[model samples]
Target chain A: MACFLVPAAEAVITTVASKVMQSKESAPETVHISLDGSTVTEAVKTPFSKKLKWLNNLLWGGSALLAFEHVWHGEVVPWFPFLSAASNPSDAAEMLHEMSTAGVTMAVLVTVVWCGMLAVSNVIENRAVKSAALLPSSK
Target chain B: MTLLTTVFAAIICTIIWYRNAPKSQMKIGILCWMYWGASLMWLVDAVFEYAEIHDEYFTPAPIDMLNDFYLGLSVVALGLIIWLVILLAKDPKGVVKSVLFKKKI
Candidate 1:
């Protein structure tokens, strides 16, 4: 239930990062035009960073939807003891601890795996690019 | 139960996605994050529940556990659906756009 905050936090971080990146002097090179003629800007991100960025966006968006669903179901209230399912302070605390532990573990694991994957892909891509440069294509 | 299940599913999906994701594609990562995020939310909920129920938490009624299991599955499915919608809307690889605008002789 409380895990929703993780995405909310991510959304805030991404927004700040985007703003900072956009304000930099090298911002012009980051801009690109898509097929639909929509302006897209490069965020000066590595593969891992890009993944994290989008991941945050996904989490934020999904959490918002879930929250809306919960509210509609009357499972959550606007006042204290927000969740109708959580009866007391002790229950809330216990739930929070459990969720925090799981969330932290999952986040850490996903991030590590992502980093490893990006590293491997970057190596392979670099090798291919280098080999292509060496073997001139026939015009 | 649903929280735990979604957490596991998210982690597994992340591992598989990372293994197969191309250098230019980050969509899978988004899916990973979404599920993980939901798992975390459930986790917090569990903690509070456990605290309130204390020993009783360990001896949850069978029906409640079963209900939780189903809820967890639904969450996983919903997460996937959300991710798919995002992937389609973003069209990061342009596959959808290409199909939509293909020439028809």
Candidate 2:
């Protein structure tokens, strides 16, 4: 379950790293693992790691939720009635009730961060860069 | 999770969208969608929580879809921000004063 966080973080990193790159063609909305990860790690560690730790957390956490859902809903679901959100009078519902709240909060933060980035980027839209590579490079 | 994290994410998403933004006035329109989407998840949910606490039911299920849509938009925006950040970093002196700080030096 925890491993889910790794991918979420990686996704953010991947997105950010890709942002730093200008592919010869159109800018891609989502990118996959096309190369080694060492560069991405260094990029995150560098000063300009893109925001959304909670988002990454929520993202991976959402994935983790899916995994848990699979486990309880698949093999041993009936035994663990508490894990089912749809099941009446169960702990799962209680947790999701609270979790939805958290998810909403996560959503808001994501929105804010998105706005701020746009503000900054708007200011620099016409600015120049030599080469927008995918890894960390001090400039 | 933390204030910085939240701010960073917002900024990054903004930058991402700016980088790939269409060269039309509609760019702002698109951004508004992203803005609304990103804010929807938390702000609306927060309102929902408050309403629930106050014994009020503020949000409808249809509204929830709007929230998720914005969230997804923000994710795309974040990716755009990253691309811009790299561009800015590569040409700080050129890109900085105008788009970045906007102060004469």
lDDT value, candidate 2, whole model: 0.41
Write down the TM-score for model 1: 0.56
RMSD of 2: 17.2
Docking quality of model 1: it rates as: incorrect
Q: What is the C-alpha RMSD of each candidate to the true structure, in Å?
A: 8.9, 17.2
- Models 1 onward score TM values of 0.56, 0.25
lDDT of 2 by residue, A1-139 (tens): 1122233344466456545543333433332221342232111111222333323433443333333323433422446452344455565556556555554455445545555865675344312121223335412
What tens digits encode model 1's per-residue C-alpha lDDT throughout B1-105?
Answer: 777787798789888887886674547776676776566555556676787788997887999898777777777777778778988999988889999897888
DockQ of each: 0.14, 0.04
- Evaluate residue A109 in candidate 2 and report its C-alpha lDDT on the 0 to 100 scale: 55
lDDT per residue as tens, model 1, A1-139: 4544454565677667756664553522221222122233223324434445654555574466456546645656897778765777786786577447644544444345446756776676555444444443411
Question: Compared with the true structure, what per-residue lDDT tens digits does model 2 show for residues B5-55?
Answer: 333555654576687565632233333333333333434444655676664
